[model samples]
Target: MICYIYDGSFDGLLTAVYESYYMQEKPEQILRKEHFLPDFFIEPIYIKTSKEKAYKVYNAIKDKVSHEALKYVFYVFLSELKESSTLIYRYLKIAFKIGKDINLHMHNGIVLSVHKISNKVTNEVHRMLGFIRFKFLASNLYYAAMEPDHNILQLIMPHFSKRFSSQNFIIHDRKREIAALYNKEKWVIVDMLKADGEKLFLNNNDEVYEKLWKQYFSSITIENRKNRKLQKSYMPERYWKFLTEML
Candidate 1:
């Protein structure tokens, strides 16, 4: 079993997939930087981040499935489950053989698990769209920071880019130590701590948007009809960091 270890980047995972076939050996498992490996150690092959090969795999999936399906695939990739890459590898491989019905294989645990995770990522992505609080700092760049347990920032960018098309914004995932920067027109994602925190959390951009947002959030509460229990039910305190009303 060729165990492929990745550099904790989705691109690296895709590259590993390419290497899997090229190596002519089926991988027993795929893992990221922080995950534990099996007790029975196999030679761990680390795949380099190859954008070209990554796009090759991306196009393969996209050509077969709809763009929305591709998004779901990426969402599944973002799941923090231990066997995520292994499952994704299995899913994508079968996708080549079965086409769109790959998702319909609900009886298959791996496929089902990925579908469930895709929903969670999508839900979190939508929630973050409304939950994110941007601040304007010294450099006039807008920035927001979060440490989502799941990797959902990339999935949240389009929502912000569309809604705030005229403004510049940056989102940092403290858990991943990566950030996405949206210039006026386009968006680019990079490692937050790669060089400096110029456009990261506590960067050159911080304003009172958070305080204002919290104030407005508090002001809008209907005191008479406030149902603490129901509010908590709908928007649990656990997800408060990703909810404006709770922020």
Candidate 2:
């Protein structure tokens, strides 16, 4: 009935792992403090986030385990799945014991779960690279919006930053209300409000371009060869809201 509560950050989660080892106790659940609900029977222990302690666990996963294991651990964290903290904790325990061979043991449920969720997050990142449709605002900044299944704003920014390095752009995750903003030199993730995002006005040229793009999209379609099912498989209905052609 022992549970650990943390600050809901990657470093905070790592610090919880460090505390478990430091205290020599195994917690049944490791949850973010904000998400923790009081239980009459369970004893919840709050773990403070420490940069030094977090780094200790982080380095151990990379040095003791494989660097790829560290990457999988991070992807799982970004997934925001329920009981993900506990899942990661169990995965790391097995990883520490088996070292790099942990990846080879997909037969293990913990290893398999970690890999599966990590791949789900990664696949979304790959899909988003092509699916992102940017429009020019009145301020000349390029803007794009998405509501992905995972928290992948920071994950996909490196690609856009390189591809559009000469121009400023904002990739907004509407679901998370957070954005990755690049100013032609450096990129930073910041919290943005719905009103703020909605206020971005498209220039006349951009509006015309959107109309032309939509027309081109329709012109390229063959009525007889159209496959709605196949198109839905590649471009899910959920993403249609942001696609100009779909609109």
RMSD of each: 3.6, 1.5
Clashing pairs in 2: none
- TM-score per model over all chains: 0.79, 0.95
Residue 227 lDDT, candidate 2, scale 0-100: 92
CA lDDT, every model vs. true structure: 0.75, 0.90
As for candidate 1, its clashing pairs are 136-206, 136-207, 137-205, 137-206
lDDT of 2 by residue, 39-156 (tens): 9988999898999999999999999998999999999999988778899999998888889889999999988999999999999899889889998887878899899999989999
What 10-residue stretch in candidate 2 is worst by lDDT?
A: 200-209
Give the top-scoring candidate (lDDT). Answer: 2
Cα lDDT for residue 216, candidate 2? 99
